[model samples]
Target: MEPDAPITIFGPDFPFAYDDWLTHPAGLGTVPDEALGTEVAIIGAGMAGMTAAYELMRMGLKPVVYEADRIGGRLRSEPFVEGEPEIAELGGMRFPISSRSFFHYVDTFGLRYSPFPNPLTEAAGSTVIDIGGQTLYARTLDDLPPIYREISEAWDSALERIAGFSGLQAAIAARDVTELKRRWNALVSQWDDRSFYDFLSTSTEFGSLTFRHRELFGQVGFGTGGWDSDFGNSMLEILRVVLTNCDTDQYLVVGGAEQVPHRLWTHAPQQITHWPAGTSLSSLHHGAPRAGVRSLRRLGPNRIEVTDRWGDTREFPAVIATCQAWLLSTEIDCDEALFSQDLWMALDRTRYMQSSKTFVMVDRPFWTDRDPVTGRDVLSMTLTDRLTRGTYLFDNGPDRPGVICLSYTWMSDSLKVLPHAVERRVELALAALRKIYPDLDIAEHIVGRPITVSWEDDPHFLGAFKGALPGHYRYNTRMYGHFHDQHTLPADEQGIFIAGDDVSFMPAWVEGAVQTGLNAVWGVMTHLGGRSHPDNPGPGDVYDALGPIDIGK
Candidate 1:
């Protein structure tokens, strides 16, 4: 049977068939025997780094992974304690069903997942939308006020009218790159410079609604909190989220999402090249990864040298940097000429959004208790205009203790809590929630100390994830297309590649990290005289036609 076309989950602007590419049985590419035993230095042990190393291992290449902290990177699952049953997802928690690349490993590892409690999702037993000191409870959107309904309708109509939502979604579902690209490129030209707020404010459908209705829509979005914080961001970013159905039908990994990478570290699947059948990443590296990469420099043609924090150094025919882009200049001493001036500007200008989360352990699923007056759950997944922009409830089971993300704030709200202690952050969030659930003694059910994260405060990550500002499409295009530059760049720059969510068109999404990892794998394989099967071409194989929209020109 013929191979199927690549699925267009990310649209034409970032055309890459993640599902087809990941599920392909022929494998990504085959390296020659001479290149089989060669080593490839992979910086960072995050999703991208692990993924690339995993695929390359199958191709028979040795991958030496370097990690500054732990192996999981942003897919962090903070267990309450050693034997504690509960965990707080300090980094990536919920994932959309549409992320095929991310799920490939999840399914590969036999990990289980349950629906995430986001707003009106079935997993979310009840929802409480608190704004302007007024509180409302609902099971679905219909239970909300008529204004809320109207606003929701306006958004649907606006997407349909302005962006051809139906047509684009159908194209994406069909995996029609030609149609997806045409529609998305047109949108790129039209919306790249525009803000998400501009799209909402000027929409005829939304214009008919009252300003307060619009404000409510911004505060309590369909599945998340108010999107006002995203208003200043490029419309293309919002379009990508809606187009991909990223805000709904999501699931949380049962044990911990971090297990995906951890499993890959030791998993020895079939069809491996050089090593024996039982060879695993952990076994190959003696169950320990090298320390963080402190410097990267092009030493000679088609070769790069990496220096770790301990002054340890190694040379490889190729190197893939999976750390955050800013780390190249901020954390690592890299050769300036390794990347072009334009690419450097794009990397330096990459903007990451601030995000903070405070999670507390509870004695049980106490929130399931019914209210005397409203006849609804005493507490629910919350979205409010207060400091706690979004609050979530996680139930381990009726018998076990539950976890509650007391607060999930972003941007300005995240910055506000940067200086607060974890206990203080939890206290402040509980204080805000008290206004909505005054009768409920939320603090009484607390089981242990609270856990918190300020991603921006971490030197390695710098921030939560990339939030493309207006006119950032050009920069993103350059970064996403860096793999193809290997052919045009000087010989010294050919071996060093960049892969991570930050380097992908869809930053903040694990799928981006996975897809870019695959892309970099393809690039690295070819750099060592390997080639993908013609029938199963990699992203770079057809990148000229499916590359990102060049809005800068």
Candidate 2:
């Protein structure tokens, strides 16, 4: 990284330099002497919750973290067997390099990473696109037929026509907040009410081409795989992804993405305020977090009461809730008066997208071998229109066992096998792969039982992440702005806040979670009579001027 790295994840909606604010030498902020040793309740020990807790601990406050399950929430990586070292990444496997805030923690922990084997990238070695009863293999986009290249060109033209792709990206690279808001605010008004498919169909470039061109683009979309499942999502959601480069230059943590948060939980800041040099989040909690929070209610004047599942109740001056939004209504028995009716409406209306993954450990990296009949790989990283929407291959080493994500699907596709067991899911995937590679026997090489996860099926996480629909920008604004805007609310509601990717502009990205967590740090500090260093103003300081524009009623 450069000496002064520009934060690429600086929002198109809220253009705050979270990476810079976090890494600044001045530190996050300082709490009053009276507030020192004050306890803060952090519900759900996920990425956002953990980030806020860690930072708050640094400022001399004791953070009480509660978790329903393991330390890493959606960043789960389950080992294949009790004794085996290799594992399958059930969630958040691929991470984009442009997510500067997330990578900040990665570099801090001194963890290793490698390129994720996404479709059509050099790391994959080979990619196969199988659609409409036809199959083709490629080392790059140019290796495919002329029609595929034409579809790619059409998509590029469409983006350039509607989004001013080059200029907008230049602003992001330069961190020009003025030009960014001017252009992005205009887009929020025009595109907020439209769907991704609407953006594609209405573009003059795509309009000039045949319907088949659009269909082909959907099958082999840029970054990751087909995005047809996201056709129903708001156009603003898709634009934020491309504008922030969320889907490009992605890599996976060497062992698993879960290690990032785990390290944060145990990391001790060298120059922490109010605490001893060796004190860490783990030492503060006695090496174990509290049980899951079952209920939450306000106690007025910078006080909130939290009750764990085991009926252990505690009160704190400030609280940060990082669980999925839907969980507030369903799993946790939260009080009605903690927020306004409008806020509740926004939380209830937030839509979530479903996702599923199935994985199996193979004997070895056999897929990399060349076939006798054809001089190509025996099996390639695959994309298909079958039930198995996408298949990814992970090559551990020449001798070590390799792992294969047999099937990965989203939205409607994820629902198809949600009722089936892991074995059935693997069977369904292998059956689909047979059509793409008739001679290959994927099931025969499998050594152990398969592993799978349907995020929608998990009660704790009703769905994978928030996928806002058309006309839902108002709801998104209300949720994302709640922390800063809560100052106008009643005293009881002011100190209780929400943080997570679900409340951020760029949902599903780890950077969003980290940014919101930092926002909560600012909010909590200000509520407890603390202030950020004058040299480095926090998000709340710039929110009024730079926050997302409100599309008025």
Candidate 3:
């Protein structure tokens, strides 16, 4: 089947088949008549949804945003000790410099950022690993055995190769298909359909390097144990990271990543009336075409029904969905078949790894060690002891007064075991810290425990971000095809469209979400033609084409 063709699937019972639910009196009654009319309806008020709404309002379309939870879906900030001056991120923390669009929005919105120092420079304590029951204090990757070195080399090489190409166009521009094919082959080979343990068993590097790589990968990637975690999991994600790093320099957002959407909301034009709460979209009735196409449905063409905690429903013409593709596939009663089959299959194949980040507050500026590369005290420590993955420190700078934040990234599959796991993790992290800063009392200086955000269990978020498992990348590429090049809908199929990070070229980062929302709005405007509003022109008029902007400017 062609990639862009609509997907159809059959099963004993289509779990997502919403026809029955939509037609049921309870379901139909859930939607109210008042919600039958509006210009646009936006679901999920994360960065993607907010950006889309901002763009729509700029184009003269008033959009109503429906959020199941807080406006910032996963991009949330929590106070560490409640009323304390310090704030820590419980969800979606870092933003790489490679995210050009995200940075542009930050700059355009006047959000500020301090330089994030290299995280591996500072001396933390050390860990005594029981290798064959003989405990030894190990510090750096060098402490790993020879076998682990080989695996690290392979992982690093794969990363470097993917980092070579700047963009899809640049990759395609290479005249030497042989070299390209060779490189692609090497990278694709890593996505062998096998479990991580199997791959490790085949590897000659079973010492520290192997241990370090597995722990780090599990912590950063899966968020728990590397035991059953498949190395081939999320092949597309690995590719996306390599491509993003290669494309441009990445940076973290200042004052937390949530500021990106908050800025967009602030900058939205005044003409657009963001509908009040309690709007719900019912059935969409259409009329004949006028000029091009006129949606006779009470709501313009983008019909959306929004219900709050109280269950009041309101409608809008157009709706933009910017949450996880899986959530939308299952939760929303739209064309279930259009998104469900692939989504369900992908979800079944994919598993979310648990991550726990502990932020440690130090008494003073401790620059005990310096990174050879970045020459900064901020340390990025990776453990090979199977206890935890790694820890990254963010120097609060001289202005913040003895404030240093350390993030311990741990991977676990079970949230039920998180508390005990976290206790073990803290113990291990402190033990590792003692190796480097033996003279300093880490326990005395340690003012608080780490804050954990279980992205895997977050009811609204189901997973940290979208990741592919083994063969799922190919399937995603195929699924993404359905929405990318499609034309605007006719009156018959008006008011139904999808947008989110899951629909973009990148996988599950801020860049992907922003790019997807931009494309969605652009596509809508292009189909509508004319001016979207008086001041803001439609997509064709605003920009030559819907593509990535050069964020370097």
User: In lDDT terms, how accurate is model 2?
Assistant: 0.89
Model 2 deviation from native, Cα RMSD in Å:
1.6
Instruction: Write down the TM-score for model 2.
Output: 0.98
Every candidate's CA RMSD? 2.0, 1.6, 12.5
lDDT of all predictions, in order shown? Answer: 0.88, 0.89, 0.46
Tens-digit per-residue lDDT, 1-553, candidate 1: 1253222356557667767877788778888889997899999999999999999998999999999999999999999876665999999999988888888889988999999999977798889999998898889888888888888889999999999998888788777778989998999999988999899989999887788987998888787657887888999999988888877678999988889999999898877888898999999899999999898888888768899999998899999999999999899999998898888999999999899999999999999899888688999999999999899999888999999999998899999999999989988998999998899999999988899999999999999998899999999888888887798987766888899998987788888899889889999999999999887888889888788767656
The TM-score, computed over Cα atoms with residue i paired to residue i, of candidate 3 is 0.64
TM-score of each: 0.97, 0.98, 0.64
> Would you list the rank order by TM-score, best first?
2, 1, 3
**Using lDDT as the measure, what is the rank order of every candidate, best first?**
2, 1, 3
Q: Once superposed on the true structure, which residue ranges of model 2 sit more than 4 Å away at CA? A: 1-7, 82-84
* Residue-by-residue lDDT tens digits, candidate 2, 1-553: 3445443888889998898998999998999999999999998888898899999999999999999888888899888886566789998999999988889999999999899999999889999999898899999999989888887887777778788877777778888899988889988999998999998888887888888878877877877999898898999999889888888889999888888889989998887888998898899999999999899987767668899999999988888999999899999998888888889999999899999999999999899999987899999999988999899999989888999999999998999999999989998999999999999898889988789999999989999999999999999998888889867888767888899999998889888889999999999999888899999999998999999998997
Model 1 CA lDDT for position 99: 88
**Best of the candidates, TM-score:** 2
